[model samples]
Target: MSQVIQDKVIDENLKWSKINHDLIRTMETPGKMWWTAVLVCVAMVACAVAAEIYQYKYGLGSVGLNNPHMWDMYIATFVFWIGMSHAGTLLSAILHIIHAQWRKPIYRFAEAMTTFSLMTAGFFPMIHLGRVWNLYWVLPYVSDRGIWPNFRSPLVWDAFAISTYLSASALFLVIGMIPDMAVLRDHTKGWRKKVYGLMALGWRGDDRQWRNFRRTYMLMACFLIPLAISVHSIVSSDFAMSIMPGWHITSFPPYFVAGALYSGCAAIMTLFVVLRYFYRWEDYMTKNIMEKTCKLTFAIAMVWTYLNLIEFSSVWYGHNVYDKELLIDKATGPYAAVFWTMIICGMVAPFGLVFQSWRRHMPTMFVMSIVLQISMFTERWMIVAPTLSMSHAPHQWDILWGSVIEWAIVFGSFGWFSLLFLLFCKFLPAISTYEVKELCFHLKHEIEEEKREAEQKAKNTSAAGSQQPVSGSPGLEGA
Candidate 1:
């Protein structure tokens, strides 16, 4: 009899009941390490707030913005966080549409990351605005004096894109959580039950409810895929629409989208390892799934690397003196260190995943994921800084090293994201309970089918053997 082989996305022996219990337990327990992390995140957020206050009072100069280097770390950090927000769309929307079962265990946290990163990214533009009070001026609304914001400015595009993407992503997140909220509502007590009940919208898990849920979820996933793509493309247009030498490239949109997906995937890997180890979810977040994630990340890394090389090649050969000069400056000038770091981490480092052992090794994958993100962070910095430093007019050239306030604000943004995510972990299920149960159900069915096939094959072989003639007996004479 031939063996039927299948790679499990989760442990084959896990039961639906246990899947529910363990996932619920994740929200119920709070250990010292979690509390300590929350406290540290709070402190970091406080520093960021203090820095923003100082900047608000003292004007943009507090963060070292000047004539040439008008945009600095704030813009870079904005792009970084915005890129990070793509992870949820890639994991949740794209994978869901394709019915990728492995994503079920990890997509919930990735969705939350999308929302929180968008919230963090939204802060940077306001912080960049020296007149924070006039934030609404960027809106398309007209003032009483008939003054309106610049219609063609990339800032307006960002305002529209960010708001739309944020609203859609937040809605998608909440909609996806409803069934889990219903589970929590039924299982919990006190204020949590009440909160979950309200959040659940009185879900009964009846046939009609599930049918509608499936339909709505699929629709949202479909809508979000293109929306996610467009959002980052608009962000890229913030540069591409500009006449600046390096920023005005035609390839910037696709380049930005690829880079965003690459960074987002890396961020997901980092969190995947963290949640697996911290929650002891070896059965649910199995190595098979991690390996698949690594493979996808590796593929995206290659796409991003190709795009990077294309940009360099185009600039080098296109006979654009300003663009070529700026490219050379980025490679050989003060920012060369950061430029090469991006190249190594974003392009070369992902090749480690080619080794099956490294991809499955959680600790190594975790470190590599963080390194990839650091590379992405430097990439955004390189994008902004080198362009501004190598401006068309040599007299306007200046490199912004950024000030302490800028650094503090960027640091705080991380803390803020962490704090929000921690609260999400406390109150909400990081793993999709119903989805994990679905995986368990499918795995059990597959195992049973394989067993039945093997048994049937064995019985058939025995019967055939029983009917066959012996080598030196009556059956051989009959044959």
Candidate 2:
């Protein structure tokens, strides 16, 4: 049995050592395109930082926020980023528990997207604050003035939730990457080795090391599922807790969660196709995975649409005059055009994903992913904007089109997230080397088991033929 297992372990394609080298090679010598992308991202981030500085010096009046529209694009984008962060942890945790093999390659980058987007999401509140220097006040602390933030405030609640989500995501990402980092530490020399070695944290890949790593990883994965759900549910509460008609729906949490997962899944498609092309990792990040992601996105899209209709129906059916009017405002109000566009993107566009051609075709899926992200972004904006625009009291109502600085920050966030992800790709194994090795190990084990069964069946057949006259004669006496 041991020899059979040993022979089965002889995988031509997945020698653990060879996989380390192959994956590490992706980071070895990036091309001109990689450098170019990094430079562009840095430039965008610089522009954003510069814009923020200008806004700081010039004051909140530098942007278009006012009256009923006090919360503008920053809040919307923040929500969108929060939503974006969901799919990563969801894919990593949920699929992992279900033992989905496709998740192995996808989850590494998906989890990275979660961490980077959360970092990006974390910044929006400060950017929205306009007076970002006072950002520390959001922390649960008392100054010499003995003033404390109202724990009852949804904003404060959001602060706690975002901080906690970001921390958990960072821990999850770092822990998962340790084994991969250790692989890099072993393969490199000098500074690179030193950095990877430190991150690897003395991971020697021994029996004890393996046991502890698996147990810890599993615990974190289990913990992250509820954490991920709660993070977005809390985000939804930022709106749902409010008295505003659209924002005050009981269904907002699940609605927001579905939207988040919807957007996150689309993001996975976007990154999946781009990285597959750029890294030429077709075998690992296959078309099958792309189609699977599309199916998920399509399913979630339907879910979001259903929630949209349900929310609308509840508002329309309810005798609450204010809520009914708000529903009317959404369809034909000042920013009704934005709402309709969102409908087309969010409610309508996902229908295309149902086709195999759209799901499997890289080009189509890429375009669809982009559309879905934009739709989700607009959906967040619509959720916040319309509620504020037509607040129950007419006097408090104000329409806000985001200022130039606000737009710049939005672009800057994209740069910030993309830059972090690109850096991660350049440094760490973009796909999990250790996980893939384990995958190959299991596949080898299964193949060997099948081979043993085939051998046993052949031997039994021979034995039966040799003993046919005597043994079969007893049973065949009638014949």
Candidate 3:
């Protein structure tokens, strides 16, 4: 017991200095490229704001809203951002539940992605609602007119679902950061120390604090998994609950959920590569973790492929002429190019990950991630636009594309999300410090155990060889 305790103490001490030095280094002022990127992102966001202001002064007509195709790029962008948010929670919360120790090194930035993506997603509904001032009316609160938001509406469902998810995800990200913040607090001096100290919630790393922290974190993780699942499912209902033939499918919720996880994993890789290059964290963010993430993404991609096939097959094989016509229009009409790009990127590109060596190739993975990002965005757009463009009543049919304001808002959302993430890197630990130490502890033990086993095998072989064999034994001559 004494030896065990001593070993634990030594192991804990082993990683502290290196972990602190490496992680805190990310918070230091970055290079010229980073600043350049920040300036570009800020400028783009300014342009987006200006575009929105113009749209506000004018009307929804600025986004080319027609009778049949009212939902355009705004709704598509909303789904895209919402899907991006899912990977973070899956990386941190679900992996934590499964005791995936490798998640420790990468989950911090992934969860940060979740929090920021959700913030970006929250912008779309207000954009969709031309009278953005009445945004609060979507809430469940009672008003002076004794009115309430219609609970039956999927839009209301989206309000409750997204708000709940944002709150829980924010809590999850902050709570997980506290212990690492405390580590930062102990190491820093003066102003930075005080800042981390406050953010750490006075974390002390005593037995009681750890106990409470673990329990609370576990409980929150349990809550977030279903919440994450529900948020996107509700987002799907905005289309599925509608009476439109193509939109009224039972498969949408699970399909949306899978797409969310699929795109999310790709987004993580995108951010992972950027940060790894800039921060020089090649050690913790190793090739093996990247390989695992790629493999997971490949699997989700297959799942999404199956779901996509199922949607198309169901539409074709079933007796619904309206759905079949919409699907046909999406494949052969003006949007055919978008549909094929989604197929090639979303379905075919992931197959490249089947080769283990290819998965380890960083540049290959990065480019593939970009492809998936485009494919996923187009997937959401195709889901919304093509079906609406082809109404059951021939007279109601109309082709529609997003306007300049809509395109500006899309670009702006990307800039806004990037700005938040860059600021996060500058201020907080991009990688979790103490969690890396914990990972170090487990890996150190595994290495030590393997060494001991190897030594024991060598000893046993030596002892057996040294034993005098009978003269008649065939093995004696070789020995």
The lDDT values for all models are 0.91, 0.84, 0.88
332-382, model 1: which lDDT tens digit per residue?
999999999999999899999999999989999999999999999999999
Clashing pairs in 3: none
lDDT of 3 by residue, 53-162 (tens): 98889888756876776778899999999999999888999999999877888999999999999999999999889889888888778689999989899899998999
All candidates: TM-score: 0.95, 0.91, 0.94
TM-score-best of 2 and 3: 3
List ranges where model 3 is wrong by over 4 Å.
1-15, 464-479
Q: Ranking under TM-score, best-scoring first?
A: 1, 3, 2
Task: Please tell me which model should have the higher lDDT, number 2 or number 3.
Answer: 3
Give, for candidate 2, the lowest lDDT window spanning 10 residues. Answer: 3-12
**TM-score of model 1 vs. true structure:** 0.95
For TM-score, the strongest prediction is 1
